[model samples]
Target: MSSQLLMIEDDTRLAEMVGEYLGQSGLHVTHRADGKSGLAQLQGPEAGPLPDLVILDLMLPDMDGLEVCRRIRSLQGPAAQVPVLMLTAKGDPMDRIIGLELGADDYLPKPFEPRELLARIRAILRRRTDGGTPAATPALRFGSLEIDRDARTVTVGGQVADLTSYQFDLLVTLAERAGRVLTRDQIMEAVRGRELDAFDRSIDVHMGRIRAAIEADAKNPRRILTVRGVGYVFAKQQD
Candidate 1:
């Protein structure tokens, strides 16, 4: 069966084009032109079962795309866990960072090739699926911290840590290579399966967030140590 995708976009032409392309790729898409309708589709029972993923445009006629992203995240259970890929016309990296911090799984700058969009969508979905598997390694334990590759969850002191999907993947990558120093480029490539955009600080931002959630003292992180001039290492801890 095809995966259901909800696209909240205002451009009719672009929506049709993207819908047709994604449909050809075996995804069933439902398009909403504005934020209000998008929210209704997500909240109203007629929206059918929750979509497998959401492609949200940052600009809408009635509301900010970021606000919509927040609402989607606020939904209960599986609905709140839906993967979201943001589409933005703003070239500022801050917007993308804010969107990611607000629960967007990924972001694509507007005026992009359809193929790239498809690749991003596939990447996010792939991560949501078997991305955590195939590691050939068992769950990692670090004292009070637990990184469950099979379950794709992280817990600190037996309490579930609220991490974005990307953050979870980042933690897994670092843990899988405990004690090895991985540069920012290496970490990004390993977790995202892509290179960082030179100046992209999203990786650091994510690392800080992860530390805050898992570390005993985020201000002085011990598990993920910064090497200053080098990279970072996942301190081999004792349970």
Candidate 2:
């Protein structure tokens, strides 16, 4: 079955172009012009099954994309867990960082190539699919924190931790390699099969979000520790 994608973009021409282009690759694309209608579709009963992913534009006529993301994350059950890929026209890094902080799975700046967008979509969906496969050890436990690979869930002290799909995969990558210090590039490559930009701090932003979700105290993270002048390590000993 073709993967379903909901693109919440106000740019009619761009939406048409993206929909058509992605259609060629066996994806079903649905477009909603503004944030409200897009969100309505997700919340409406007649909308049927939710889309596999969402492509959201940062600048919306109805609301800020960050607000939309926040609302989506606050929704109940499966709707809240839907992966979001944000499209940002702004050149500011803060917008992207804020999007990630609000549970966006990824972001693409404006003027990006269509192929790059397609690749990013594939990577996100692939992570979701890959994460469900049964493994030798389906779950990882570090002290009170538990990571279930097959179920794609993280729990701290028996309480479920809210993490975006991308963040969940990132946590799994580090937990699987517990005790090893992996550079940002190495970590990105492990999770996304792509090298990180030399100056990209997206991984750090994501790490902070992950810490907030699973750590007893985000200020003093015990599971994921950052090495000064290096990358990060998932401590073998925790809590």
Instruction: Give the top-scoring candidate (TM-score).
Output: 2
lDDT of 1 by residue, 9-46 (tens): 99989999999998899988899999988878887755
Candidate 1's C-alpha runs over 4 A off are 131-137
lDDT of 2 by residue, 1-239 (tens): 89999999999999999999999999999999998888887887537789999999999999989999999999887999999999987578999999999999999999899999999999999988854546556589998999988788899999999999999999999999999999898999998899998978999999999999999889998889999888999999967
TM-score result, candidate 2: 0.96
lDDT at 31, model 2: 95
Cα displacement (angstroms), candidate 2, residue 186, comes to 0.3
Report the poorest 10 consecutive residues by lDDT, candidate 1: 130-139
